[model samples]
Target: MSRTAPAPAGEAAPPRPRRRIPGLGALRESGRLFALAGTTVREAFRRPFQTRELIEQFWFVAAVTILPAALVSIPFGAVIALQVGSLAQQLGAQSFTGGASVLAVIQQASPLIVALLIAGAGGSAICADLGSRTIREELEAMEVMGVSPVQRLVVPRVLACMLVAVLLNGLVSVVGTLGGYFFNVMLQHGTPGAYLSSFSALAQLPDLYISEIKAVVFGFIAGVVAAYRGLNPRGGPKGVGDVVNQSVVITFLLLFVVNVVLTAIYLQLVPQKGA
Candidate 1:
């Protein structure tokens, strides 16, 4: 064992060593993130809302995400339709192909696809922009000028993400449904009347409500994750790219977990139409 060195005659004794707590850093980071999310939500409804910034960010997010989301939905819908149609046919339930395929797309694939695109495209952009500003000390400058960076900057971006995600969810559902319908009719030899009728019979308003709710929740999650990472980047300018990537990955993981939870909750709370 090693002994401590003696202090100077008139000097105070050295301080005792503090124990390190495992995962304390991680826990603190998580707490900070949740606090920031709460602050953003509360501030979002406050007056003097940044209307112009909100509009601009909304347009930017939509612009970057719309075309790619549309293109991806086409193939995603077609694949879901083809698979479900084939399976239904094997089970001698081909008449329900439309209901199965449409429900699969709307209830599952559509929100996921929208969320993926939002996090990948729009979220990455948000992270990059905020991270860049942070590295450049712009956020600090704003603070020096008596502006709350989270309020003036983060709120608009997060709100924009939510709005864009909601609108894009609707677009994706419509486009994907059409794509599924087209593929099922053409490739699977599905009857148009039966497909339409089955969908109408099986689908309920709550289905749409759940989808939109998921979109909203997913959007909020993505925006918050991106903002949190951006606002707390490491290694300065060069690390912004790394922060963006981390935000995307984190958002994706969180989205899937949240999706599962939301889907489970929805199923538990909402009764089936024919059940």
Candidate 2:
């Protein structure tokens, strides 16, 4: 047996490196996500494209998302109409209700509602699917077979999400506008002619364009975030659930920030015109 003697008195061992703050860790993760998104984009346009997978993802996402989108848009439009109509009546600006409600729905509500549905319904589904595959070692087996999982698994999903988002945005805009019209005319006893007349009074071409742009951007963000969380899960069924939860939370936060930034830019570059 060998005996070691300690000769240090009043001397301390070296301190371990401190862990990064949670916020800093989140920033680092976000940087990694951005990098992953760039890589996905690069691989998306590569040869031997996965057209079948893209189509499958498109239908799957649409099937799951459409009902929720429709449900939410109707109530959303009704609420906006009710509130705006009441306010217009109070301010004696009833003639402007159509323009205000339509503008509000298209400019803000529709995109936000569609984004929420994408994140809550479609994003969670993606995360769960990929997370299960990850836990099952399917992704690892793909790597062993020299297949790029990002190209095979993520790119199609991302593209499909973007396509569906554009379509859903248009659907939501139409449905929400109709819902608002129904409420304004039937429930509030507003003149349908006035509502129809002022519908586009405060809107410009840019409004529709911006709404579509927002849908595409939000869809891309949600897809990338979900794929990142799913592909990087720790392990086990619980890990899948955790990743799904995190993906939704992260997507929501990102959407809110992106929406604010995009709205600010739109306001600066394309100010709303008078009725």
* lDDT of each residue in 67-94, candidate 2, tens digit only: 9999899989999999999999999999
Superposed model 1: Cα runs more than 4 Å off: 1-19
Q: Candidate 1 — what's its lDDT?
A: 0.93
lDDT of 1 by residue, 131-186 (tens): 99999999999999988899999999999999988999999999999999999999
Top-scoring candidate (lDDT):
1
Candidate 2 Cα lDDT to native = 0.91
| Residue pairs in candidate 1 whose N, alpha carbon or C atoms collide under 3 angstroms | none
Model 2 misplaced regions, further than 4 Å: 1-22
Best by TM-score: 1
